[model samples]
Target: MKESSATLRDLRPTQFAVGMIHVRRKMAETRAVCADSRYAFMEQRAIAVVRGPGGVLHVIDHHHWARAWIELGIERAPVQVKMDFRDLDDIDFLAAMMERGWVHPFNERGEKVDIGTLPPSIAQMPDDPYQSLAAFLRIARVFENPGEFNAKFAWADYLREHVSGDSGTIEGFAEMLATAFRFAHTPEARALPGYRPEAAR
Candidate 1:
C-alpha cells in the first residue's frame, strides 16, 4: 500500500495514447499546480503498476499524466505497485494482465496488434486522433461515463469510424470534435460505450 518513487524513464506504458492533446494540457496544468508552494507534486501519485518480468514496472493507468510528466522533464514520481507479476512465468503474467484488463494491445490505427508491439516508454506512444475526439466527447457529456475497463478505447474506436483521419491539426480537431459530439447523440452511437438512450437519461 506504500508508494515508491520511480524514475519516469523506467515505467512502461500499458496502452497507446490517451490523446496527446490531453497529455499536453495536463502537463501545463500539472506545472501550474506544482508551481504553488503549498502543492506538492509527489502528493499526486500515478496509480498502480505491475512489476513484470526482468523488473520492468508496467503502468496500468494514468498514462496521460505519466506522459505529461515525462514531457515536462520530470525524472521521478510516486508510484504504487498494485501487483508483482515478476514471480510468474511470462506467459502466465501476460495472461493475468489481459484477464484483469491491465493491458491494451490496440495501436493508434485502432487495430488490434501484438501486445509485444507496445512501446517500452511513454515517449514512443503514438497519437490517436480518436483519443482526442473521445476526450472531447467525455467533456461534452455526449455519453455518460462508461466506467468500464478501457472505456476510452471503446470511445476511441467509436469516434474512429466517424472521423476520416487518424491525425489532425488543432483546427481540424475542433471540427472533428464538433462532428463527434453530434454523432454521439444519434442512434448510430447507441451501441458505443456508456451510450444512454434519451429516455434512459
Candidate 2:
C-alpha cells in the first residue's frame, strides 16, 4: 500500500499537538469516543504547504503534504485553517508492520505469512497521538521521570542558543500561527467536524 499522508513526523510541532486535540474533540462530538478511541494514531505520510513569495500561505489540499496551514490574518479575516488527513491506509500498514513486520508479504509458497521480527499484535494507534503523548509525558512528570515534552523544548532552546539575538519576522509569525491554532475560534466551533450533540445522553 502507499504511504499515509497524516503521519506524526509530517506534522509541525504545533500542528502535531493541535491535530490530536482536534481529533479528540471530534470523537467526543461525533459520539464515537470509545475505549479504543482514547489513543489516536498518526499514520506515516507527507504533508505540504503552498506559500507565496512573501510567505503568505495559500489554501490547498496539503493534507497529504504539510502539517497544517497557518493563516495569520492574511487575506481579509481573523484567521483561517485548512487541515487535511487525506489518507489512512498507509498508517495502518506501517503500524501493523511496526509490531508484526509481516503484515503484507509473499512467502516461498506464495502464501501470506507472519515472519516479522517484532511481536504479532500491534497496539492500537492513538486516536489523538499528540494528546496521548502529552498525557503520558505528564504522567512521567508525576512519576519524576525525564520530561518528554520538555526535552523537545530544551532542544529548541539549545538551537536558539547558537542563533543570533535578533530574531526576525518569520519566527514571530510562526509563533502567532501556533498561538491562534491552540485555542478554538469559538465555543461552538470547538466541536470536531463529525461531532454530534445528541450523543451526550
Candidate 3:
C-alpha cells in the first residue's frame, strides 16, 4: 500500500474514524519503539527539558502522526485523522525551509566545536559512550540515523546506574539534543535532505 502525507482535514468523517481505529490498534501493539532495550547499558531516564524559556520539550514517536482532540466547551472527542509520510513531498518542505533561512547546508560536524562543549558535570561520558549507545540503538532500530542524533541521555542514565553518582549530566545532554533540533529546524540544514542548491531556491 502506498503511504500518503494527507492531513486529517483531507479525510471525510467516516474515513477519519476508520483510520483512527486502525491507528489506535497499531499504537496499542507497541509500548515504546525507541527507548527500550534488554541491554543494561542502553537504558535512558526520561527528563523534561525546557525548549523555549517556558516551553517544555515533548517527544512523540513518529506514531500518533495524525489525530488530535478538539475541545468545545469541555465536550470533545479527539478528531481522529489519518496521515502517511508518503503523502508529503519531503523536497518541497526542505525547499520552503531553506528560503526561510532555517538551515545551513554543507557544514561538517567537526566544524561545530560548540556542540560537545558542555560543562564537566553535564559532559561525562564512558569514552565515546555516545558512539556505543548509537550502535546499540541502531541494532534495536531506535533512530533512523544514529550518527545524526546523540544518545547522551541514554548513556547518562546508564552511567548513573553503574557509577552511582549525580554528575548533572542530564542538563548538558538536553542542551545537546536542543542543538541538534535547532539545526534540523534551520533553513539550510533542512534543505540537505530534499533541496538542490544549484537547481532551485
Candidate 4:
C-alpha cells in the first residue's frame, strides 16, 4: 500500500518483448491523458514494481505506460512495490520470480533467452509488432482479453504464425488487424487464450 514516485529512468523491465507498445499510439494516448488535468487520478494508479537486490526497481507490469511516460518527457511517475525481493540473493530472487511467473525471458523472436539479457531500461526494449496486433485484436473484441500470464506473448506467437509483415502506419496495421480478426475465430486459434469457438461467434 506504500506508494511513491520513481523516475522513469530508474525502472527496469522484467520482459524482453516491447512489441505491445506501438510508440506512436501509446505516446499519443499518454499525451492526451497528461494534457488533461481532470485525469490526474491516473497518477494514483502507480506502476507495479518490486524491490530487487542492489535497490533495483524491477517493473512487474505497465511497461507500455512507463515507456510512454518517458516518451512524453515525464520525469517521474508513481509506483507501488508489489513485492520486495531485495532480501533474497540474486539467484534466489530470479528463481522465485520465474516460479511465480513474474518474469518473462523471451526476446523479440519469441525464443526464450537468458534473463540477464533483458533490457536494462524500458527504452532498450525491442518492438514486437505482433504484440501490438494482439492488444488491438483484444480491444476490438476479436477475442476476449487474454489473461495476464504472458498473454501478449501468447497472442503474438499465435499471430506470428498467421500474420506477416510489420507496419507502423494506421492503414497498414488496420489491414493486418483485419486478417488477424478473421484468423481469431478459426480452428487454428482455438488453443490461444480467450479464443472464441466458431459456433459461439
Total clashes in model 3, counting residue pairs 3 or more apart in sequence or in different chains:
10
**Residue 112, model 3, lDDT:** 24
Instruction: Report lDDT (Cα) of residue 194, candidate 3.
Output: 26
* lDDT to native, each model: 0.77, 0.27, 0.27, 0.78
Model 3 stretches astray by more than 4 angstroms = 1-168, 193-201
Q: Return the top candidate by lDDT.
A: 4
* Segments in model 1 whose C-alpha atoms lie over 4 Å from true places: 34-42, 144-148, 165-167, 196-201
Q: For residues 56-75, could you state the per-residue lDDT of candidate 4 as single tens digits?
A: 99998878778877777888
**131-186 in candidate 3: lDDT tens per residue?**
22223333333333334333323332333233322213656544543443333334
- How does residue 195 of candidate 2 score in lDDT? 22
Colliding pairs, model 3? 4-87, 5-87, 102-186, 102-187, 103-186, 103-187, 103-188, 103-189, 104-188, 104-189
Candidate number with the higher TM-score (2 or 3): 3
lDDT score, candidate 4? 0.78
For model 3, the local distance difference test gives 0.27
Clashing pairs in 4: 19-128
Better of 1 and 3 by TM-score: 1
Estimate, for each residue in 48-77, the C-alpha lDDT of model 1 and write its tens digit.
688998888999978877888889887887
Alpha carbon lDDT of residue 65, candidate 1? 76
